[model samples]
Structures are given as structure tokens and as C-alpha cells.
Target: MKLARLGVLIDEAAMKRLHSYGLNVFERYIEEILEHAGAPFETITDIRALDDRGFDIVIASVVPENEETAERLWQYAEHGGTLIAYGGLGLLARRLGCRQRPRTGAGYARLPEFRSVPAPLRCLSAQPWHAEDAGAGAIGALHASSPQGELVGPALQTFAVGRGAIHRWAVDIPTTVVQLQQGTRPVLHDGIPAPDGTADIDEGILKADDDIELDWEWDREKTATGMPYFAYPHADYWREALMAHLVRCALAKDRTLPLLDYWPEGTGHVALISFDSDFNEDERAVVTLDVLKKLQIPSTWCMIEPGYSPQVYERVLAEGHELALHYNALEKENGIWSLEEFTRQRQWVQSATGLARVVSNKNHYTRYEGWGELFRWCEANGIAADQTRGPTKRGNVGFLFGTCHPYFPIAWCDEGNRRYDVLEIGFLTQDLNHPNLSDTTVIEPFLKQVAKVGGVAHFLFHQIHIHRLEPVRQAIREVVGKARQMGFAFWTSKQINDWQRARRTMRVTGIDAAGQVRLERGTVNEPVAVWLPTSEAPESIQSPGIVYRYGVPCIKQVHHLTREEAEC
Candidate 1:
């Protein structure tokens, strides 16, 4: 069977905002989601030439560039081409079963078919539209809370044209996903009120968690510890739903797309345990190391100033654990948030540990000030991964930053929305057993949701807690055990950074008309997983670099293939 090809139509005007905002939700950000899904697609700017190219399905990420473009899209759908309008359908409003709603207010949206998980209605402000029910059935609906109480209307709907259909999303899926992932620009200081004292909001520094837009009541669920728990990754869910719909459209056209598995060896998901080595407590480090040794799992130890003894560092290296830097930018401990301080501390740790380079870092107390300065410093210091973006308050635990997936952040101050060399691996919460922070109740749900979203479930533990608190120790053991039972492999921060960077280079070179896919990767130190959607298992397979294959049941039938670097 032949696989259908997809074309992503983007507004060049909207993408121009990348210069100021670092990224535009409707443009580069949406493309990132599609790339991660491993869906074969082409970006088209000229809608006039779209009819000539053989694209089975088209995603109008832009609200019709002009009248000609809008007419062309409607004709394409009428002539048997699947068209998915991301947000604004402009001229095709009445044709696609939607009437413009003249109102702007705060609201929440839920897809009943998708477990009724609620997400903020972003499209209402962009282009408010309600379903007309003129041959189209609503797939999802939104409840807008204005001064006039609440108004319920259709949020998502699909209707057939001549031979094909058009699926419209009123929530501006791309914008919502991007906002959830990157968060808003921290202009001056605080965004969310930290009444729990987890952070000193009045300090006038914009911490990573401060940029989070999740509402305490609307986005989080109540926990056993009475803390606000973010069980659902609204952004990732939107991305997943968008991709699932695209895949279904392709399948309807007798096509299949390839997807890159999140973990190595076809692992369902991954979990990472990291420690902030506060005050260089070598004795406490030993106790934590003992527990990890008992479990035979490697961990990442972030070294603060005046780190552990040389012997302890040697032991950590010998035990296959990673040694990383814990940057302290707090004012109380004579800390300074500056590039000079970062370079100084980075140099001290590297010299003390006898290492030429340190690959990872986590800030002390998650102290952040500016927007992209931390990322710039990381790139300058050659640090590949940073784990500071997470919930400092117990109320913000679980997907606080809207993702567990590590990604290279775009330099907000840089031109062309250029990405930094550093990959941010945002932690979920600090010290699960901490009374003022989090508890064990979130472990199972957090890990499960992360696995569903196919990202790392990274948790932070301080050496001080591990040494002083028995509950913390037990919590660590339980979390690791549960993750293992759920098919999650534990990995250190360095390992994750290495694997993710290596896999980023892997590209789908081509997919033939006969559904055969060709992939290309640069020289990598480890093997990567590539999955292909198939209706049936192949009796025999022949592909270089792929050393093993496994059958894994998912939303669809897929064969998981592990592709290793070929022998030189």
C-alpha cells in the first residue's frame, strides 16, 4: 500500500514573530511537534501550487492567507483532499460548519472522546467560532467563563465536502501547545502567586516555574497531600491528538507514517533520578550512593561549590554515575546570578573532579532571573543539559513546565529564533517526601502520564533530604520500583542528553511509494529506536543498522526496530 504525503501550510507573516518571541506557536513550534511524531511532511508556502503537488492531506496552520488561498483549499477538499484547519478558517467559516462568535473571555475546552481533559481555550481570543451543526458533528466543546457566567459551544468539528472532509479546531491547537511548552515571557518578575512559600515571589527574579500559565483550580487535581497536582500534560495531549488525527487521515488514504520511539531498545518510557549535592555533604552522598548501589541504578549527582572529596568523585565515576554542577544563584548564600559566577563555579567543579568537561547542571533553588540568559550561559559553558525548569512549590508539581521531554530551547534574544546548544530536562518536583513540597501520591500517575506522552519522568532529590529523611529514602525506592514495573528504564542526565542529541540527528531521508522508509543518522555512540506502522508483521526483514526488531501494540500496529551504528 502507498503512504499518503502531508503538506503543512504556514503563514510567513506569523513566523516573522520568531525574531522577537524566539518562537511562534503556529509556525516553528507546530513543525517541531510534527517532526517529533516522525510524520513525513512538506512545508508549503504557495497554496496556488498545492494542487499540482500530490499531497493527500493538508494542514492549514495559517488562517487563509488570501481569498485565492481560501478558495483553493475549499476546492482541494471538494476534490477529495483532506484539509485540516488548525484554527482560523477565515473565508471557509460557513462552509466548514462554524459561525464567528463575537466575544472574548477566559474559558476551558474538553474533547469528550479524549477523557475530557480540559485545556485553556486559546482560539477564542484569536478567532472565536461556534459549530453551526450544518452537516458537521462536534467532536469537542468549550465553556467560556465571562462576566455573563459561562457559554458552552463547539470547539472542534469535522464535516464532509464533496469527496473529502475538513476537520476544524477552534482552540488554536498549535498556539496552545507552544504556550504550554515554552511558557510566556517573564517580563519583570512573578506570574503565579506562590502563597505556599515554595518561592520568594517578591524577590523580583523570574524563576522558570514563574512562567507557567497553569491555573490552580482549572489545570490541577487535588492530591492526598492537599497540594495541587498537574496530572495531565495538556500540551502533549494536544500534540498527540493532532498527530493521531493526521495519521488517521493518512491511513484513510492508504498511507502509513514512521515514528521514532522515545526510548532505547523499544522501552515504553524512561525515568531519571538526580541529586542536588547541597553543601557538599560527602557523608550524605555516601548514604544515597548506598541506596542506589543496592538498586543497581545509575544516578546524576549535581556538584555544588566545595564538592565532595576527590575519592568520592572517583567513586561516582567508577560506579557509572554522572557528576554534574549545581549552580547556586541564591542571594542568601553569597550567590550571584551572573555569567561570571557560572563560569567560575563551572571551572571549580571541572578542576575538582579532574574532568575536561561537565555535561549537565541544575540551579540551586531553581533560581532564575532573566528569560534566556541561563540557557546562554549553559551554551557558553558547554553544558549540554540543564534541569532547573520545574516546580519549586508543591502546588505546581507534575508537568509544571508542560513537558517531561528534553528539548533544545530557542534563544529568545537571538535572531531567526535560533536554538541554543543546551537541552533543558525539566524536573517534575523536588523531594517527593518533603512536607512543604510533594508526596508519593504523584509518582504512579506522573510516571504513567509521562510514559503515555513518551518522555522522561525526571525527579529531583537533594542530598540533605536523602541523609536526614527516611521517608525520602523510601519514596525514592518506591518511585524507582514503580517506574521499572511500568517498563521505564532509569537513566542518568548525561545518558539522556547523549541519547537525545544523537537521536535528533536521525532523519527520515525518504519514504517510497511502496511504503518502504529510508532513514539516515550521523555517527552516534549508541543505538536508536525507529518504529514503522504496519498492518501486519513482516515474515522477513532486511535493513542495515537495524540489529533487532520487536512487536509492540499501540494506538496502531507498529514494529519497533533498533538501529545501531554500523561497524566502521
Candidate 2:
């Protein structure tokens, strides 16, 4: 459907409570979810200024201070508007036909449809208030204990209004928002001793076992039915579930529009074969490059140091592969780098490669502390994108933000909730993470998931690992073959970054009363894919650089044009 106009009511008093509770109070995570879902929204602090005609859906987290505010919200819903109220908003519950009781002890919940993999949600300390009304339908079932306990009540609910509806999430939405936005869990201990037991690898460099394995389980039935399985409790699945609910609410109000797809040209999925050049051996790097060349895959090579073999860089460029910076600082003390160091190192690579700019990078050792500053540094230094959003620990591999697609990160620490200029390409799978690299099966499930969602299949491989370990090479080869078989379009990191940048700025300017669609080109010249939800496919289509593909739904793409015209 057409992008839904959303409005979030900000309650100052609710902010105070959330802050006093030591939970994250920002709405940036919600905005990020909307942006990725292609739903445009605005924030409203003054309840009087809210216009039901303006927003198709309105979300509020605080209880109304007086009867007037509650009456206004009730009137809006009565006029066929969607209202989503988070817990702690007792007035909203009564208006939506539910009775909110006193808060209960900490517990867990089972959200089956909320995620591909249904994980038991452990609502520590801030257990949701129990609902006492029979009209409230359960969205999630609560457990009495932490991990697994006896059934208690509904953790989330929905109730019907006059001509609209209200979705009440019993648990704390802000807490989940904060956890998803920060992307990093609390550092439990001083350090994790390496397998060899020589010394600890600093706390932030790798995630603790508890953080990685958060009691998440795969849904066997869903898997058997060929549904995508995203690891639950991971930020991505939660974000996905939240957005899906929001979209469902919007669609319930109106269902005559089309939803946006992540990729262009209606491609099933995109693949990036990346290699981190962290070692000192030029021969090893060359060997890995040879393997890629033989596979006919255009990969991205992230160089760790400045002075790599000139021949290697030259060959990479000549073979149509991309050269990117792998910003390296092996020592724990150097987690955050100075802007001067960033500029100098990036410049050195640019000078050697003879390219005007180097847009892609992955931090050495995956040192991701000070990410907000690092991304700002990337923008300042003209770096267009980064792939350092992966989990710090090697053994744990999954989406940190619950997506395999590239997105502009909402500046977590920035005021005014601004977004970063640099695009974040989520890491899909890595070579060094697995105990045995020969087990090509480690990535099969993930690849299948990405393909199911038509997401980006980003694969990170260390050149040294591939050169030293035969299994690593075999694994890469097998994965590459599998992706090709699955109909994934192979791309360099820069290509993915460029396409995402263009898509982010692209917009639908208008649809005339006569049903003609108007468009505006984004900042880039890349082709844009326009997905139109239609009941029946057009017999034939006519437009420059535009192609129509029919499936359960169909999408139209208009490419290489500053301006174009189309009819649905």
C-alpha cells in the first residue's frame, strides 16, 4: 500500500518515568523501523495539535494526564483512525475497552507470530500490567517465570474501537526500543579468555555467550512450511514484528496502496562477497583474489594496512573488484581512531588505487565501540558506507539490527534524533566465526532466510583464513555456488551502498486523480524499482528502462531517467 503517514505522541511525563526506570527513552528505534519499512512518520508533542485527518495511525506511550487528552484520542479512533497505545497508559486501555490492573512481577511471554523464530520474551523487572477485560484479544501469551513458566495472561492485546482499533503492548516498548537502538548489550565481565587461554580479548570485542544465546529457538513448524526463520530476541526480529503490526494497523484503515520492496529490478536477493585483508602476506591475498576471479564474482577487498602489494591492488581493480579500507587497530587501547588517522589511511588507499574515493570499510578486529563517532567520522572523511555493524564475537553470527538490508543508522546519541549520512550494510555471515570452516551448512539456513525475504546476502571472509585453511576456501566456494543457484545477484560492496543511497532518496511525488503515477529521481543516477501492488498484471507495459514482473504481486521499475511517467 502507499506509505502510511504516522504520528507518535511524545509525553514528557512518560519520558520522565522511562528515564527514572533507567530504560532507553528515545523514539529513534521506532523511526528506524519505519524508515526501513518505507513508512514515513512525524513526531507530535502537543496533543492539541494532533489532527486525525493528518495521520492514518497514531502511537502514544504515556497515559493521558487529564480527561481532555483521553477524549481527544477516543474521538480520533471513533472517526476510524488507528491508535496504538503502549503499557502504562491506563486511560487508553479503558477507552479501548480494556481494564489495566496493577503491574506484575517480571516474567516471559511467547510471541509466536511476532518473529520467525519464536523466543520466550523475558520481561525483567518491568512486567506488563495484566488486562482484566474480556474484549482484549491476546497478541502474546505471558509466562509466570523468566525463561519458561506457567501461563499467566496476555503480554500484548488488541481491542476494537467504534470504526478503528487499539493495539496495546503490555510490556515496555521503550525498553525494547532502547535495546534495539543501542545494538550492544551490557558488558558482563572484564574479558573473554580466548580458546588458547593466554589472555582475555577485551569485553567489547566479543559478545558473551549469554548475550549471543538469549534463549531463542527456531520454529520447527514454520521452517517445515518454508517460512524465513530470524533468530528471536535479536533486534531484527523484534523490529520486524513491531513494523509488521504498525503496517497491519495502517492497512486496516485503508488497503488501496502498494508496499515498497527493499531491492531494485525486483531481484530475488543480492549477494556481496567481501574479503578482509588483515594479514601481512601478499601471497595469501593474491590467492584469495584468484579464487574470486575463477568464481567470476565481483568481490570487495578491505585492506588492513596502507602499503599492500601494488600488483594486488592493481589486479583487483583490473578484474572489476572493489578495494575498500579495513581500518585496523589490533590493540584494545586503540578502539577509537582519530580523524587524522582515518583521513590519512583512507587517503593512502585512494592514492594507491587511483580511485577518486573509497566508499566501503569494515573495522579491523571488528572493533565497533564509539560507532556513533566512527560513522560521523566516515561522513566527515567522505566514506559513504560501512559494514562494521556485525556482532563483536566471532562465534555468534546473526543480524545485529534484525535486517540484512542496508540502512542509514538513526544517530543513537545525537540530539533531535537525526540520522547518520553513512549507510550501514548488515553482515550476513562470516568465515572465521565457525569452528570448522569446511561446514558449508553453517550459512545455508541464513542464505535461505535472506533469499526468502529478498534481502542482501553479505558474506565476510578473511583472506588469511581462506589462504591458510582449505576448508574456508571450500566453504566460500560452496556458498557462492549456492547463492548463484538461488538466483542472487552478485555485487560489490560499493554497488550495494550506491543503490541503497539512491533508493533512500527516491520518492513518489504524486498520483493524479486520473490514476497516473508521477515520480521524482533521487540524488543518484541508478535505476529505481517501483513496486505497485495490483490485483491483476498488466497485459503489456511500455516505459523507458521499466520492466514488469508478475508473481503473487508485481513491481515496476523505471531506470536511467531523470523523470518518467507510468500508468497502473
Candidate 3:
């Protein structure tokens, strides 16, 4: 099946603002979506270039400013090209069969096609819109509900233009998504309300929980104790919705796009279980290691300063587990929160364990301050992954950052808006045994949601609790069993970091006229999955399985060989 050529038009000026203290998200969010979807796309800065290149699908993320660019896009779509655009397209809106009305300051929007309820959507323009008539040819795919439960107008409208079509999102999706992921910059020092009673205000450190962007009353479902049990994954859901539309449009043109699977060998889902070794509890570490051995699951042990004896570290490595640094930034005793302190701790752990490199780290108290600083420190230190952006309080337990997948965070401080080299694999909740915080109740639902998105379900536990508290020990065992039963393979953080970074290097050059997928792969040591949408399963496949790509059936095949072997 010939795949449609995909291109994202960039607004140069808007992109420039994204790096600065401006609200425009531009192509950053779009780049994130395509990266997660594993779709091969090019970034187009010039509008006229769309003509000669003949892109089958163009994402008009950059709303045309002048008449010439707008006319070019209109002509391209009229001549049979799918154009997916966000926000307003100015005068071109009426020409494409959409009508705009007075904008409203609403907080939410819903895409009924995804069976979605109203999720938090912050308009970068500070105004959420409801389309007027959208004309007769336009169909509303997403809409915002009124106070009395009426669908007043559409946020996303589709219009059939000549031989092609245009899907327009009336709201600013890029800024909303980036906000959902990174949260507001210069986080308020006052901190969000901690009604669940987990906030330790005396710490004087701006913890990760301090910057909770998800609304406690609106974005989460509560438990009996008024703590959050279910956090609606608005970011992930929106991403999936966008990808679904892209796949649908591609299929309409008799094209099938190849998507990269999240896990190796067509695994249904993936999970990561980690332990924070607080105060270097060697005895507690032993008990936890024993449990891991019994379950045959490899885990990541985030070792703090003056970590366990050499024997314990050796045992962790011998058991095929990962030894990662657990940086101490809490105010216990001389716990500093700076790059220099982070480096000192990292070096201490390396010297203590006699290890050459430490690939991952997580803060002691989930201690986070400011935005992008920690990421920059990790980048400088060669830390490939960090698991610090998660809930430290009960009220904001699940998907607080609105993602379960490991992603490279963008350095908002950078003038170029470059993504940090570090990957953030945020955990759902820490210490299920912690009273009023989390328990086994969150396990099934959390894992289910992660599996739904084919993302990594990461859980954190403390060695002290795992050994001293029987309930915590039991909780870990039960979660492991359930995860395995649900087709989730438990992997170390290093493994996940390695896999995601490796997969990012594999490029889909294109799909040929003969229906063959051309690939450009980096040095891959483990299996990477590439899914091709097909009407029927191929007769010959290397470790093939049946899967769905944005609701379309596809045959998933794993690539395990090197570039040379693949060519042969």
C-alpha cells in the first residue's frame, strides 16, 4: 500500500516566539505528535514549496498570513490534498466552508468520535471559539458544551473542498498540549492546594507536586477521601485523536501509513517498576531484591548517596536489574538542590559502585524546581532518563503531567526551543502503601489506560516500605502478576531509555509503489517493531502479529537484525 506523503507547515515567526516567553506553541507540539505516532514527515517553512513537491497531506499548523499563501493552500486542497489545520485560517475559513462566531472564554472541548468527555483545553489566545454555521458542507467533529448541556458550536470542523478535504481545529491545540505536558512556566511559589494532606510546606523546596497544572476539582475523579483516583489523560487523548484523523485521511486516499509499535515483538504493552533506596537500606533492599527474584522481573533501583554495600550493588547488576542514581535534594541534612549538588551525588554513586556510567536518576522527594533546569542538568551529566515529574501528593496521583510515555522534554529556556537530550519517564504514583496517597485500587485502571495508549506504565516504590510494610510488599507482587497477565513486560528504566532512543533513530524512508516499506535504521541491538496497515496478513513475516494502527488493522513485524542484514 502506497503511503501518503506527510508534511507539517511551520510558522517561522510563531516558532520563534515558542522559544521565548511567548504563548505560541507553533510546531513543537506537532513535532511531538508525529514523533509519538512514528510517522515520517517533513517540516515545510515555505508555502509555495507545497506545489512542486506534491505532498499528499499537509498539516497547516502555520495559518497562512497573506492572501498568496492562503490561496496556494486552498488550491492544493481543492486539487485533492488532505489539509489538517489548527486555530483560525482567517479569510480562508469562509472559503473552506467554515464560519466563525464571537469567541468564548471556555475551559473545555470534546471530540465525540473518540467517545471523549470534556477535557481541559487552555486556549493560547485566551479565547476558546464555537463555530457559527460552519456552512452546509462542513461537519463538526469536536465541540464545546454549554452550561445547560447543549453542543453550542464546534471546536473542530471538517469541510469537503472539491476533490480533497480540510479538517480545522478552531482552538489552539499546540499550546494546549505543550501546556499540558510542561505546565505553566515560572510556577507560582504559593503552590496548589494540598487538601489531601501530602504537602510538606516546611521543606522550602518547590516539589513536583507544587506545579500541578491539572485542576484538582475538574480534571480528576476523587476517591472516598477526596484524593484523586483517576486523572483524565487529556494530552494523550488529544494526541491519539489527531493521529486517528491523520490515519483516516490517509486511508481515504487509498494510502496506508506505517506506524512504529511502542514495544518490541508486538508486545501489547510495557511496564517499569522502580525502587527509591532511601537512606541506603541494605536489609530492605535485600527483601525487595528477593521479591523481584521470585517474580523474575528486572527493576530499576535508584540508589541514593552512601548507597548499599558493594555486595548489594553487585547483586542488583547480577540479577539483570539497573543501578540508577537517586539524587538527594530534600531538606533532611545538607540536601542541596542545584546542578553542582546533583553532579556530586552522581559521582559519589559512580565511585561507590565502581561503575563507569549512570544512565538514569530520580530526585529523592520528587523534588523539582523551576522548568527545564533539571533536564539541562541531566543532559550535561549524560543522564539519559529521569523519573522526577510525578505526583508527590495524593490529590494528584495519576497522569498529573498528562502522559505515560517516555518523551524528550523541550528546553523552554533555550533560544532555539531545542529538546533536551534527557528522556522523562514519569511514574504514576509512589508507595501504594502511603496512606491516603495510593493503593491497589489505582493499579488496574492506571495500567489499563497505559495499555490503551500503548504506553509505559511506570510505578515507584520505596525500599523502606517494601521491606517494613507487608501491604507494600504485597502490593508490588500483586501489581507485577497483574501486569504480566495483561501482556505487560516489566523492564528496567535503562532498557526503556535505550529502546525509546533507538526507536527514534529508525526512519521510515517511504512506502514504495510495490508496497514495500523502506527503512533507515541506526545501530539497533534489540527488536524494534514497524507496523504496516494491510488488508490481509503477509504470508512471510519475521515475528509477525495482528495489531491495530489508529483503529485500522495492521500486521506488526519486528526488526532485530542490523542495517546490513536488513538490506540482504
lDDT of 2 by residue, 1-568 (tens): 3555678787656555555656445453555555565445677766776753477788874434677877888777777777886565566665555555656665566677654434665453343545566766787777765556766667677777788767777766544544443444443444443343222345545322223222223221123323222343344445545655664565455532333457765466899888888764888878887898789989998877644778878888889899998876546535345677777778877887777989998877665454366677799888998887654443345553455767676554323335778887767557833453214544667777676555678888888888887778888888889888888888988998877766666556544554344555556454555554333435543434333321223345444564443221
Which candidate has the top score in TM-score?
Answer: 3
Query: What are the per-residue Cα lDDT tens digits for candidate 1 across 1-568?
Result: 4556788886465456444565444345566777666566788865666788878888887533567877888888999998987667768887666778764445666565544233443322334576666578677666665212365566667778899888877667766665666665643576656555544445555567767766555566766756667777766667766766665566667666666666655556888999999877789888988888998889899999888999899989999899999998888888998999999999999999999999999998788866678888998899999999887777778986667888776645344555678888988877988777778988988987887678889989988898999999998998989999998888999999988877766666666665556666654444455555444434344433332122222222233334434443
Between 2 and 3, whose lDDT is larger?
3
* TM-score list, all predictions: 0.85, 0.78, 0.89
Better by lDDT, candidate 3 or 1: 3
lDDT, residue 432, model 1: 84
The parts of candidate 3 lying over 4 Å away from their true place are: 11-14, 17-26, 97-106, 114-152, 194-204, 222-227, 512-514, 525-527, 534-546, 557-568
lDDT of each: 0.72, 0.62, 0.74
| Clash count for each candidate, listed in order shown | 0, 6, 0
Residue 116's lDDT within candidate 1 is 23
